[model samples]
Target: MLFRNVISILLIFGTPSLVLGCGFPPDLWCSSPEISEKCGVEKQCSLWHSKQALTDVPLVRYELYYESLCPGCKQLILTQLYPAWLKVQSIVNVTLVPYGNAQENKYGGKWNFTCQHGPAECVGNLVETCILSILPFDKAFPFIHCLETYNPSTDGKYCASLYNLLSYWPSIEECSTGPNGNSLEHDMAVKTNALNPPHQYVPWVVLNGVHNEEIQSQAESDSLALICNAYQGVKPAGCTKTGFIRSPVKKIL
Candidate 1:
């Protein structure tokens, strides 16, 4: 399926509402107490988190359901998602689901997966899943972007090293190669399958827990604008109305 050619299928919430933390999603990058305590001052996360919290502004939800090795998925991640995230991360609750177009079956008392790209892609998915599970969103996302930037099909130790995350690689390796990874991928599968209208392609973008043609097109073309427009509270500097129009994101490939 083409990346920009989105199928407008609406999906229902398949899981219970996860508890929000620090006025946003628990997995939100820098708003939680633990994250704030650890790196808030260093990262200057307070400027964004405190602003949103004080204003009682609800964060715009942005979710991407994609596979590891899909070219279009990589394009969106590298060009659109990552760049837009850096600009609007504070006002957006971003969720990355890596298992896409993959089927699961129980055989020999174990779960087996068939990925869209190949076995390598399944491994890539596990690596990403392990990364997301091991680190908070703030740390996990950069590593993921690095992985996609270089090569998603290989072991992600290089990306981990880039982020001083080698200390956590052993745990990530263990989880990815064992039952932990399987369970995580299964949860992803459940979420992907639960789409009310069922996703028709990878790089499926959902806005505010709902998916449609207009939102998907807007997200793929310029996710920053999409998030900024969807936001209901104070606009971030990038999305300010002081004659600062965000340039349209150019497709990398």
Candidate 2:
């Protein structure tokens, strides 16, 4: 299955609403206070995005569901996702869901998970997800890519101090190591299981809630081309220069 990093927002009178878009759901998302706190900032977040981020504006909601230590996942994220983000960050909202295709298991009062790369990958998954929960996308992403670039061969807390993410360790350490961490990962598993047409592997890619098939093969090579073609507004000079045909994405009815 494919995991989605969906967030929820709390209402004025305490009613809750499901929120799915880029950025932390909303401040004070009461459904899960501790989890929500990790995604919150000192200032309250607005349910409404800035004018540039409104629906009318052409936007590509890039959804990447991948394991933290998978080779293909790492390649696409560092080469495809990050670079494409730099080019079109003004017009896109990239959401990363690090759970990928793994399932969680429980036994003997302990929670466990398996990753394509082995036990170490599972540990890396928790660390990455924990980072995202606290840091904004821009900060969290660079840390992820940097660690991958510096030591793709090894994955885990080794680079936490290297990136100074350890400064936020107090905030995330609880979320990544205990039952709290288990619950957070559980949320990801739930979202992954809910994909309308479940995915077949890691690094599943989607744009505007639809699957992008061409990405499986060309992500590292031509992701910007895909996003540029899919964009539905005043074409940036970059997009026009390519004159690329719109690549259709598979929409779920």
Candidate 3:
């Protein structure tokens, strides 16, 4: 009788329908015959579909912490970062935190920021924060590139219009001018301040959550090489085109 009861309990608990929660090691939690029907059909976990299953390429994590209106930041974004992204975006997971060397204060439930440049920079940072929030990374990047290429302070709406993102402008403007912008910028500030080893200047480049002077110099000088070199396994065509990877010599057997 005890053996029968134990078998019954095992059968009940072992059924895939009884499983709860989905996570990594997707084969087990997502798509194994034991779990696939319930977990895969319901969860539709994008990570497995979009990234992991596609190529199994490990993407390099690159985070740039900078403030609007900083000359070095502008140059890096305009010349190095954006161009490199155009090439290696598929191989790099990029995050831009636009709050560098900024101080924040709260008064009466209202948050105010003091940026490194001035009031214009504060507004510019808020605008960028709103841009990033409103659009997907692919759509937001060009708009940001446009703003930095010309004038972040004045070219916001113009850039949106140029990108046919005019419909989103009203929302972006409202975000920049409202409490949402404050919250977003506050999140950025928190992330920036929490960086290990801390950031000492604008345009601080962090790779895989690590920061150092050598990374800083390399990222500033040749971001493409920096990212390509960091990535492992099945490099994208961009790496070869950019001369970062050489085709291995085949042994003539």
Candidate 4:
């Protein structure tokens, strides 16, 4: 009986089913990167290279905390922010921190808070960091898109997809199963639970390893343009201050 109980517990907690199958169409996977040479042309491909350059550099570094099963995280990446970054070819290295199952406790209890809807934002960070370490952004982008499509309501499906996507090539399954996997999630859970209390939220983006006034103020659109211009060495001309407000967390930092 004890052995059976242990097995049940392991099955319950060892792996959470957050990832489903790939959300993006198959054609996206086959598209060639060569097609997108310049910014504003085939923006997604350009951004992939830009992100690659940023991550490839030794000095520049940034961390993005996300929950793997969070829908808001998906909207933030696919609908709002990443597209812009792709257009500019922004060379910013990002770290992904996964906070699993933001909506419920390990015992399967629900907690109410600001962004507790899903785990996509926090987990997205983990996937990003894992991809950065192993595969280039070009190959990593599709894998990330696949992971983001996961629906937490289903359980483990998203995680399974993530496992499959990285199993080939550089193989990120090791990282997913390593200390960083749980560590990042634990850190994010502690921080978010403290901030909102009784509820867990994800997609906490920290720039330059500090979530201070400088990064927070600069994140604002009117303000972000200035920061972007300074960092990218370009004027903020024609850069509209719209669509950066997907999450209230971005406003904080």
Candidate 5:
């Protein structure tokens, strides 16, 4: 008999809804503010207190490095991990780092990595980070909702659609050419090597200045668990089957 560990957290109103799908069943979590309509008063009050305690803690900066084309990155973001981050919004400074040059190359109109996709990249990262940075817990829901419904694809129109969805607009020519032309490519290669030190994979996530390789391995569940553990301080027990273990967050930090 295989025993799966399912952690269920009931988030009361006023709490950011993170951890929607990582390891907890979606049915077990509720976002509605009316406690009477969603959960018992006792559970609601308890969750409220927990949320307060969580919010009082100092925020930790976390960077997630991923490729736009990687399915594992998509899974981790759209699934429970991202939701969990939402729950702890007051305590997390989340940064989305687009790792690797492939997707940017494939979409941003420049094959060689030239131009200042830096502003675009920085914009996207800062938007998410800013919401998590300044918005009240209850107000950040729409961003997460939009991210959940995002379509992950690299086809010209598909990528463009997502960019627009994020309110990220590239020039018509830039859209056709890609994010980083030859110039950005040269800069990225140099920067990635300086930062990531050249690994053999893609989708590496840096959490609190720690880079976990699970993303590169396409270990979606494992990466999610590792991310959860990093933020929640609870070791994930069921992710070994998915190929993740307790390792350094990379040597860069």
Candidate 6:
């Protein structure tokens, strides 16, 4: 009976749904050169923030704690975040946290929660977390960028195939929408729920644990510039050419 009950929580479908988001903090994230890249060069499958970061190097940690289906979240990912990745994939590491402002009510191994955008957002977050679990960012981010294009509410499965990630969709879906999926989200909640100052809204954008109000304000138009500015390493040529150093981003407490 205990085993069966545990299974129920792990596999239980969403009985209800919720929403969640961003906030301020400090050092915000530490760097440990002792730890290697978040994922190794060989390309092991793991969560986005899996590895320990090297603080000594010039690195800008862009962590987006967001809900899946939020309109603003969708816009920023496609415009600012995606383009930023293309330009600075070598210099920056972006962490996508799907447990926006939502609360997770744990039942055994199963997690029941609600999202602001409704059930779809909750479902979408699970799907995204599952993808990151198995695929590295280079392969996974493209599919995610495309999935949001057609509206995740209805075309999540189709987008997977469209982006050529179809081969992995079966496993992805099984883990995302099932007990396995629940387990992943539960872990993510543990991380997101512990944000230092707590989030005020979705797309709670942070750079190295520092929430920059200025960058968040102009994320779409100036994200790359902001990241480039935060970069402490040797500046890229593009940074000089643009002549656009974003205004200092303010970190909230």
TM-scores of the models, in the given order? 0.74, 0.65, 0.74, 0.42, 0.40, 0.70
Scanning candidate 3 in windows of ten residues, the lowest lDDT window is 244-253
lDDT of 3 by residue, 38-140 (tens): 5533233233334344376668999999888888888888777888899989889889998898899998877899987889998889989999999999999
Which candidate do you rate higher for lDDT, 2 or 5? 2
TM-score of model 3 relative to the true fold? Answer: 0.74
**What tens-digit string does per-residue lDDT give for candidate 4 at 203-250?**
444565555545433343222343354354332233544335533333
Error of 4 at 11 (Å): 67
lDDT of each: 0.75, 0.62, 0.77, 0.44, 0.41, 0.67
Weakest 10 consecutive residues, lDDT, candidate 2?
Answer: 1-10
Q: lDDT tens string, model 1, 68-134? A: 8887788788877788888878888899999889999977756799997889999999899888999
> Tens digits of per-residue lDDT for model 6 on 1-253?
3234322332343211110111111111112222212212112111112321222465678888877877777777877788777777777888888878777787875789788778888888888888888788998888788777876556767887887777888888888878888888888898888887677777778888776566567554577787777877665555554332343333222
Query: Model 5 clash tally?
Result: 29
Provide the global lDDT of candidate 6 against the true structure: 0.67
- Where does candidate 3 stray beyond 4 Å? 1-54, 243-253
Q: Arrange candidates by TM-score, descending.
A: 3, 1, 6, 2, 4, 5
RMSD of 4: 21.1
lDDT of 2 by residue, 46-86 (tens): 33222223446757777777776676777777666777777
Which runs in model 1 stand beyond 4 Å of their true positions?
Answer: 1-54, 241-253
Instruction: Arrange candidates by lDDT, descending.
Output: 3, 1, 6, 2, 4, 5
**Clash statistics: count for each candidate:** 0, 2, 0, 30, 29, 19
